[model samples]
Target: MRNWEDIGYLQIGTSRQRQAHAAFERLGILATLNAFGPVLAGTIPLNIDLPSSDLDLICEVPQLALADFQLLLRQHYGHLPRFSLQETMVRGCPSVVGGFEAEGFAWEVFGQPQPTRAQHAVRHLLVEYAVLEAGGEAWRQAVLTLKRQGLKTEPAFAQLLQLPGDPYAALLTLENLTSAELRQRLPPLRP
Candidate 1:
């Protein structure tokens, strides 16, 4: 079989992202989650979804009554399809993790401590966006092909695509590259 991937935006629209964030705001989940630190990181925000991608969020829960915050999320939004908010851990600290749907997007939020959160960069999403901006459909599909073939992380995708740097480093540096530049960056596939 040949390399298969996504050529265009996923069927979901950008509005879904706003709606989810809005729901977080309207429900005060944003502010509540923010007490620890706030961020939405994952395939959804990056707009790079596989056929089965779900939303992932990173948050840090404060030691002060984290249980109360998590409970609030579930009590307020649990009615949503597949909602399952619960206390969880990230890098050995406490967090809340679960999924909920809003305006047609499937979302998963993970609350993590500030220090642990710092190590998780959303730049991968930025890199994907930059690649999308610079290289358009072909680059996206190529990356998706790697993803579809079970190369989940960006670095693995970049490595398989023969990109010039560490998968992580290359993506951070790949912004504004043209289609030709992208093609140029790709070394010939090994036999």
Candidate 2:
């Protein structure tokens, strides 16, 4: 599997993935947010995205830099279609979320006062990737099917695995398991 941190792999990925690469490159999304340590996190990166999935980019913005971060996003993306920026509390911490449309995709830039890799989105992405890797193509299809039924990614996985409680928190429990271990928890593979 390609390292999720490096988007270069997307160039040779599925059609949607390639389109995402083109969109990102044409818009200079990464470079524009370089100062904030951006990491693309979401179904798009994992190749489990539906037609409506937006380009989700997570960034590390210190609390003291929140204003500047919001200003920077506005300066660069405010003119795009449906541009909107807001500040809110996420998981008890301040967050800055900006959305716009560009290069044939909806883009969301999420900023939190913490490292990108340490964020819940990144961690959930890693675990989801691991589960897909362990379960193989069939499991991938299952996830897509569940998504098409209107269940969010984490909830779909939780339902499939019969997990209890909050799906997001439950999914994290499998994060440290190896492929073999994950396979044991997953349903038996179809022949």
Candidate 3:
């Protein structure tokens, strides 16, 4: 599916993705955060996750519903291992973050006063997915190798692409390009 909202595709994905699907099902994470419009983002969904990668769930939580959202998370997930909930600002927007470990994966639930699709994490995921699809397996392996060597997803891509300045923002610059344009702009694939 082009949209990452429906996670059914994960069931047929890589082994780690299948495991993630099972964990999500076991915890009912998306259902638990349904009211907030949760969308799974990050490396795991893209099949480039490191062994230590955590599940990143992004949600839309309006300011008025902040308390209820926090309550719901605490009520449902607080008893999970290492449960912690807090409020902070991300890109100047107020955000609620909760974390817990379940079924062998660390789960991070993030809520912002904006649409999940509009959040940077989801946007980055979409762009990164496009890059991976166009770059083929070699590019994917390069990104994974960089990640294993201690780089975050964005920086790994940035380093391979020779992108300058803030890797996060640089990646976004390629967000709207067509696949053809991306292929043209991307450096030749390396072995």
Residue range 44-131, candidate 3, lDDT tens digits: 9999998899999999999999889999999998898999999998889899999999999998999999999899999899989989
The lDDT of model 2 is 0.91
> TM-score of each candidate?
0.59, 0.96, 0.97
Measured by C-alpha RMSD in angstroms, how accurate is candidate 2?
1.5
Candidate 2, run of 10 with poorest lDDT: 182-191
lDDT of 1 at 94: 72
Global lDDT scores for all candidate models:
0.59, 0.91, 0.91
- Report lDDT (Cα) of residue 55, candidate 3: 96
Off by over 4 Å in 3: none
Best model per TM-score: 3
Q: In terms of TM-score, which candidate is stronger, 1 or 3?
A: 3
